[model samples]
Target: MQNLPTSWSTPVGALTATGIGGVAMAVAALAVTADPAGRFLIGLAALGLLVVTALGLRQRPRLAIRDGNRGIVLQRLGGRLDVDRTELRRVRIVRYPRLGRRVPMLEIDVRPPGADDDRLLVFGRWDLGTDPTNVFDALNARGLVPPDPHRTPDR
Candidate 1:
């Protein structure tokens, strides 16, 4: 299937947070319908409020990340994320046990200067994860990213 657009910001995230929060609230509300104790409903509403507030406070990003048939791209919006498939140098996993799961991330090297090239990139769900233009599969489709000898790795 085709992927969703890659570039994203925090407002979408806020909406999603609110949606989940709403669902939780709805279920909780229903659960407490016959409650003689108001504690349960209070707790549920508190949970929903927390989610809503958190989403509201998130920062909106100007930078957009995307994966194309060529490679993963990371640049300011309207600029390119995947210069080409070959631009995607590596796909690494950013591990955080506190987080629910391990997610694959793209380490794109669109420009060269090799090792000195420190353009850190990360993708996968947070709200933007559902996007069709992703970094991993796009670069992998073309095979490994070839080293650009014309460019040098940073010392």
Candidate 2:
């Protein structure tokens, strides 16, 4: 098997390029379009794209598994969340239908040392720029998360 990366992150270059394209499209639509309704719809779409790009940029390096299997790091808008190996309670991949296709997500349950409650962190394909199943396999290969007996091997 091929070696897996220790970290997974959104493609910043792609996000930046998308944001720039949205701006260009919005500007072009406003300049070239004579119909008010058409310009409005195009502008709205561009705005949505920009918003998505901004959110993606805010959470750079979405997930990272520390070297030597020590811990995992999650980057968020407010700050970073670090979960040590001991704190990781469970890790699994969930699949659900979205827009007529199945989407996979990685969910990690962690309990901070001395914390009374556990936290669930979920990462989607957009966040990881890859399939959650691949991340699950990588984590399993690293022994960070054990194999799930209940999970089918079809993936």
Candidate 3:
């Protein structure tokens, strides 16, 4: 696997806040619930929150993209995916509605060397850091692939 730069993960402050809030709510719920059924439900909720908190910490977003001469390797939560440079059909910067705001994504459509259908790879800010647009610039820098006409160039 080609080494790639690591991107930012979930900020520590956010994770800390979640843990503290979940603990506080769990303690208060346990103390205040008088009925056994209500207490059990509250306990379950507390457990769920704790589980989510743990997952947030463990499965924090980590992205790495390796540009091998022949293809690009994307490493994320699931695993590594290889995208052959020759197979890439279209590359564009797209905006997606996220958290009530527009987030940029690098959308790559690949036909994968004789495949009838195309596979779409979407890379968001989380996957490529604050400016995914740089990816397009980098690919263009290689001087092999021409600029995509369908998408406007980033100014």
Candidate lDDT (C-alpha), each: 0.47, 0.83, 0.62
Between candidates 1 and 2, the one scoring higher on TM-score is 2
Which whole-number lDDT from 0 to 100 does residue 78 have in model 2?
87
**Tens digits of lDDT, candidate 2, 1-155:** 24787788788777988899889878977886678887888888889888889888887789988877888888888889887888887888888889998888898889998889889888988789888889988888877884556766664
User: Which model is ahead, 2 or 3, in terms of lDDT?
Assistant: 2
Among residues 3 or more apart in sequence or in different chains, the pairs in candidate 3 whose N, CA or C atoms overlap within 3 Å are: none
- lDDT for position 137 in model 3: 54
Q: In angstroms, how far off is 86's CA in candidate 2?
A: 1.3
Query: What is every candidate's alpha-carbon RMSD to the true fold?
Result: 9.1, 2.8, 5.2
Candidate 2 clash pair list: none
Q: Least lDDT summed over 10 consecutive residues: which range in candidate 1?
A: 131-140
lDDT of 2: 0.83
Tens digit per residue, CA lDDT, model 3, 88-118 = 6887778888899987787778787778998
Off by over 4 Å in 2: 32-41, 146-155
Please tell me which model should have the higher lDDT, number 1 or number 3: 3
Model 1: lDDT of residue 37: 62
